[model samples]
Target: MIRIACLIVMMMAGMLRAEVDARPDARVAARDAAQRLDAAARQMDKATTAKDRVKALSETVHAYEDGLDAMRDGLRRATVQEQRISRELKAREIEISRLLGVLQSIGAAPAPATLLHPDGPVGTARAGMVLADIMPGVNSEAASLRAQFEEVTTLRLLQKSATETLQKGLVGAQEARTALSQAVADRTDLPRRFTADPVRTAILIASTETLEGFASGLSQITDAEGGAPLPDISHRQGTLPLPVQGQVLRRAGEADAAGIQRPGIVMATRPQALVTTPTAATIRYRGPLLDYGNVMILEPQTGLLLVLAGLDVVYGHAGEVLPAGAPVGLMAGDPALSGEILQETPAGMGIGSGNRRSETLYIEIRQDNTPVDPELWFETDKDD
Candidate 1:
């Protein structure tokens, strides 16, 4: 009877051991699948271009899903191993206890030598020997458990890495999509076209010359602090340095009285107003050119360039330095005739009248050849 029982126990242990051994194979398969999935996801994230981005995102999602599935399978196998180990441990404990009880009942102390001796019935002796052999096998199962634990840890790490990588890829794709969409929207809403006014141009020319003179006078008073005379460009913002202030007949870079392409700011004032220099600088260029009639370019310092146009007369010559607010020139013709001669004169003449009755001053500020919008730099209120 004992022999039969021992055989049955041995068979059960053998079956349990077989199951544990099989678990490692399953765990390894799961680990491999997870690693592969993670690798594929990472590869997809590195793809460039729109098509590549789409492909990469797709691949990443697929890999992530596959990895998750593998991880789940791995965990299930680990659970099975844990259960097997638990059952085996309980059976081993029971066998150990039974052996100890038998030794105690026989008035014998439990010892390795006693366990190995074949003095008892064959079946009982075999059971004792088998228990000793199984003890080492239980430790082997512990190693397998440790391996399973390691697999779980590795799988979790892979899952986290893949997830983070996928998220970053998704974010990048979304941003690219947004930028592309915005570009399309901007293309559809083009800026409106604006016609220029020849009359406004004439006014700007007349006022520009008058302002240059005032700038020259100011330069003379303040020349002690500077190297050269003030440039034709006025430093004052908003109102010009002229005594007879006029309304802004037409805006710069906008539709004017006569249809023409105007590229700069225009300030209208009395035609009789004196032209003044704004800053202490030398006159660099003075002549009729393009939209600027009777133009005068002045260099105040090293980099500052002032341009005065549409003048009755240019007092300063090229390379000649003048004081700030000094009288550089006068607006051409009488103040009242600005409107009558609007059509009779040339394209850039100092005569214009359409929207408002006033002399126009064309002023531009340039730093290193770059034309900065004077409206932003100039103060809108009265100048100091």
Candidate 2:
């Protein structure tokens, strides 16, 4: 019994003395994102061609987005973990105190006294066996408590240092956006399907009152239909990627704040988020349209039009044919300068419920000038 008690004491002491140097999984993820951002930045600096620079800058923007997301998620998880550990520790205070007292008493007693009980040798032998059986359980509990304490300390440290990481990620994202804009301006290798007839486009714009009318008259704005045949994407009908990284904010035919229903889906995205072409297609029209803000209309297939609106800066001309994953435009809003935006939660909510995504992108798919569900064509599943 004395030996068993000594074993438990040693196990607890060893656990308490052990330091937890390993970071939490969340913190590790954040660091990995940071490394990706650094790599993308270096790639941009070493790029030898305009194409390479644009690709590098796009990667840099994506890396920063991923990094900032990691930081927010890590901060939230740390806060929850710390709170849970604190609650468990506080709730088990009485039990822990009793266990500690019993251990102290056992250590204080002499070996001879412990071995010889008032009920004689048989009683002492039974006590020894019982102690031996319960030793493992006691050791397990001690180990758990020690781990919780270490985790609490680590979580607190992570929360305290998150600000610096978040700030750096924001700054890196802003720089990448600026560089990408310049690279896109200097790019001139993209193929053109046909030269746009500006006179007809201006006339059409002045006469049209609806998106349907504008789309129906798109052929009039193009000088000719002759160009290299676009690759057949009939087999990839349901597998195309979304133009931007975001979460579905509203589905097709969903009403807005003013109860006005639209035949398109809305996506919640991060500020200055890059919007790309899901497939190689001709730029039908790109500029300010009625009330949809700056829009980019893509003709991936004959009679099929994909409309993307709510962008701040639109790229490409009306006739330029862009390749898949090409930069089309960026979402509105400046990059956050601090971590305070990440920590801002809704009323009566905790830190984990907060988000920095403040921009929305509107998407629509039209077939033969008729609006269809955008989700039917674009993959809407996002990790966020």
Candidate 3:
């Protein structure tokens, strides 16, 4: 038991060390993205041609979006981890209580001398049996105690890492928010490549009822002129990042809040969390769709459409090009902190609704109007 405890302790320590080592490099990347965003903002302001200004705007938007997305992802991993750590700690408490009860039942006084050195045959047999049974229970409890202690130690290590990560994310977000605001304000006009064609407005406005129909019809229109370079999204299949950082609550074909299943994934995340793009895509539509709040649809290629819904506020509009990791919107949040937030969910709508799991993002990947699992596109950890 001691050897097992030591082995587990070593493993947990190594995991924490990996987290610490990886942090500095991530910080550097975030800093570089922020710097590039600032430079792009300046470039956008100085450019004389509409094409030059649009190119600068794209770079600026991408940088700001990437930085903000990274910061928000870090914050969410840290924040949501606090709840998991809290659960481990609670289990540790239960184990400790059971061990304490066992110890209490053993009593504070030593065994009587008469029982320990019984002279009669019957007395000796009874004493021997009692000792044997009691010794095993004591040993078992001791081993259990040791294991629980190791578990608690590992949880503490994770808690400390999460706290530090949360701090860094919050700090980075503060700085990025300022720079992002400036970069976005610098964007006044759409480049000719991103401009909306007047001929398609009537057709687009007429087909807002179904996401599949809207995506298909919208794709048939030309949002851009033949000037700007666009990404080949099909090749980025295994390389795209998740638009948001959270655990997947449901996958394609799973039932949702309304007891109706859809071809999408429901993500559980922190309230007011920022959402971004997984890859370079052009906005096809952004508006309300029935019971779902603010929705944004993006087309990476001619046939595949990425649908993101359940946002409180959306940023970019239809026909605008969004680079990878570009900010699209933020989730709705209560003013209270995580601990203070209450659950007032309706029946069947509370799949991932807990004290901290306050927001949900619904994601769907459609290829030529057919639904596909989004899990295959983004990298995921074993725990997730």
Q: lDDT scores for all predictions? A: 0.47, 0.75, 0.57
Candidate 1 Cα lDDT to native = 0.47
The TM-score between candidate 1 and the true structure equals 0.31
List model 1 lDDT by residue over 1-384, tens digit each.
Answer: 234334434444455456555656544755575575556545544543334343344334334434533544444444444445555555666554554454354345456554544556785578677666655554454454455446545544443443344344334333433333333233322221122233544444455554334333322222223333333344454443321134444444677667763544676654444456655556655556445566666665555556667765555444445445544555555533322322232211122223233456676666555555555444443231
Q: What lDDT score is found at residue 84 in candidate 1? A: 52
Best by lDDT: 2
Of candidates 3 and 2, the better by lDDT: 2
Q: For residues 176-226, what per-residue lDDT tens digits would candidate 3 score against the true structure?
A: 434444455566554334555656755675666776666666656665445
- TM of each candidate vs. truth: 0.31, 0.81, 0.52
TM-score of 3: 0.52
- The per-residue C-alpha lDDT of model 2 at residue 110 equals 92
Positional deviation of 344 in candidate 3, in angstroms?
20
- Greater-TM-score candidate between 1 and 3: 3
lDDT of 1 at 52: 30
